[model samples]
Target: MKAMVYRGPYKIRVEEKPEPIIEHPNDAIVKVTLAAICGSDLHLYHGMMPDTRVGMTFGHEFIGVVERVGPSVQNLQPGDRVMVPFNVYCGSCYFCARGLYANCHNVNPNATAVGGIYGYSYTCGGYDGGQAEYVRVPFADVGPARIPDWMSDEDAVLLTDAMSTGYFGAQLGDIVEGDTVVVFGAGPVGLYAARSAWLMGAGRVIVVDHLEYRLEKARTWAFAETRNFAEYDDIVVELKRSTGHLGADVAIDAVGAEADGNFLQHVTAAKLKLQGGSPIALNWAIDGVRKGGTISVMGAYGPIFSAVKFGDAMNKGLTLRMNQCPVKRQWPRLFEHIRNGYLSPSEIVTHRFPLEHIAEGYHTFSAKLDGCIKTLIVP
Candidate 1:
């Protein structure tokens, strides 16, 4: 099998590797058909995440055909086409029973925070991810779901992470009808969050980003107003002015570790590795939302100290909600939305790469070249 192995920061290559086999009674070996390079994957590529070992594959959003299933995997068979969520978990755990699959206590040894995530890092349970020809899925019965007959492979792959997380961000906002929502970052998650906000009855949606291409996508695909944070002297003040000086009813941070705009923050967090992630986007969310409004954080950050505005949040009485999204929890409604033609997840796909050229794919995406919004890898 050929897998993308991480050698060091900004270094990855497709190398021949041993094929995965069923390792547990509940495991399944999946032959990956489609996989995506998520925005969060860049964290690993750039050495932002801790304990991302060399030779580890980095991918989480993938869909595949079951090559083999263990005896205990009763819900699926060898030939089933399935979409696996990013989180690896045991369904019967206390957190799983409460629909908090991302925080399942029985999976990761370091269950003090996030649960097992495919291909994230040692911190999230050193599970090999589906960035290759084959991947071993643990707790197969709980995580892998058969792809709906009506869904396309591209759409199914996105549901594994990006779309699901975006919808979860909107769900966390608890948007009231006619509320104004501003989303920071125009990546896949931010675009989906902006689009989902409309479905949740937000009167207005605004997407903020530095790139013109992504802002254009926000306007056309999400049907929302767009703002380039680079254009403004102070984005929070600009947001407040746009929202009639009271600020938006809700604000979401979809840009995490590599957020630009604040020079010192980006340098200290991304370059110096001083904090978990840059607090620019999260701080913008706090400042852009109204005093009593909500702030939803869907961005990926490391498990370390970050200089966040806890004092301001408390002073303004803001409801700050954040977590690694429970991907499977959003599947039911997403399936319905896709079936009804309300969303075509494949539309966001801007590029595709073969497994052999995954390095090129990573370079293109990391550099934000070719107007790349989303890039898929066909194994």
Candidate 2:
């Protein structure tokens, strides 16, 4: 079997690995059909995710067809097409019972971590992910859902992370009917966040980013009002003006920490840098929002500390919330929506590549070239 292995920073290789089999009675073997690169994968690719450097398969969001099922897997059968949830969890844990399946105690013993994540570290329950010709899926019966016959893998793969995380950002922002929302960054996740805000009945969605392509893309989605940071004097002021000077009911830091490298990047950076999990966006989000607004950070974050102004974030009376989506917890409802045609994540996937062309896909996605909103790795 061939797998894309993450050896170190900016390094990936297609290497031969042992064919996966049904390892446990509760496990199933998936013959991967399609997979997609995620913004979260960029952290590992850039060597920013400390514990995930080596010994990882390098993909989390994927869709595959079940080739073999465990003896105990009653609901799912071979030949079933399913979207594998990023986080693997047993259904009966204390955390799962409370609907916090991402933080399942049995799957991930670490209190600091949520659910055991695929392609991540042991802290998240080191499970094999669906980034290869074959992958072992433990607890497969719990969350895998069949892809509708009408849906293509290319159309469904992007939903695994982009839509889920985007919706996660909106949920974190406490979206409500007629709420004014400001989403920072125009990456795929940010685009989805803007859409999620609208889906949740937000009055206005203002997206701030320097990329003209993304701003234009957001406009096509009717994602709030778009702002190109490079073309604006003060996004906060502009957002206020657009929102009747109330600021936004929600100012979300979807940029996470790395969307801008330093505070200068907030307004005056001379070059474009890949922004994933930068801390500067936090303070900017705090300053950009209303006094009582919420600042939700759906970007992938590490434990390492970054510099921020306590006085501003505190005095502004802002609420802060950050987390990876408890994807399994939302799968049933979200899948239902997808099945019912209420959600169309396919609009975000503008790029696709075969497994061998992954490097080019990464470069294009990383560079955000030619309006490359999202990329899929067709296995």
Candidate 3:
């Protein structure tokens, strides 16, 4: 098998590797049909996530066909096309019993915070990802579901992470009817968050980014107002002015670790590895939303200290909610949204790369070149 092997920061290559075999009674070996490079993967690519071993693969969003299953995996079998959620967890665990699969206690040894995530890092349970030709899926009965006949492979793959997480971001916002929502970052997750805000009855949606192409996507695809943060003297003040001096009712931080508005924050966190992640976007979220409003953090941040505005949040009485999305929990509503023509997950895909060209795919997305919004890996 050929898999994308990470050598160091900003280094990855396709190399021959041993094929995966079922290791647990509830495990299933999947032949990957489609996979995606998530923005969170960039954290590992840039050496932000700790314990991301040199040889580990990085991907958490994928859909595949069950090539084989262990004896205990009764829900899936050979030839079953399935979409696996990014989270790896046992369904009967304490957290999983309450539908908090992303925090399942029975998966990761360091399960104090996040549960197992495919290909994230050893910090998230050292599981190999589906970026290669085949991936071993644990707790097969709980995490994967048969891809609906009507869903395209692209949609199925995106649903595993980006779309689901975006929807979860909006859900966490607790948006009320006619509320105004602001989503920072126009990446796939931000775009989906903006669009999902509309479906949740938000009267206005605004997307902020530094790139023209992504802001353009926000306007056209997400039907949201756009702001290029680079063009503003103070983006937070601009946001407040746009929302009539009260600021947005809800704000979602979709740009994590690498947010670039503040030069010092970006350098300290992203370049110097001094902070867990760049808190510019999240800090902006704290400063841009109205007092007593809600903030939903969909962005992935390392488990380390970050210089955030906790005092201001406390003073303003803002409700802060965040989590690694329980991906499978969002699927039922997303399925209905897709079937009803309210969402088109595949429309955000901008590039496709064969398994052999994964490095090029990573470069294109990392550099934000070629108007790249999303890239798919076909095995």
TM-score of each: 0.98, 0.90, 0.98
Q: What is the lDDT of candidate 2?
A: 0.76
Name model 3 segments beyond 4 Å from true: 261-274, 304-306
Q: What are the RMSD figures for all models against the true structure? A: 1.2, 3.7, 1.2
lDDT of each: 0.93, 0.76, 0.92
Q: How many collisions per candidate? A: 0, 10, 0
After TM-score superposition, the amount by which residue 44's alpha carbon in candidate 2 deviates from its true location, in angstroms, is: 0.8
Return the clash pairs for model 1, or none: none
lDDT of 3 at 377: 96
Count of clashes in candidate 3:
0
Which lDDT tens digits does candidate 2 get at residues 55-167?
57877888898999989998789999988878787888887787776677777667466778888755567776777888898887786778878776765676667788788
TM-score of 2: 0.90
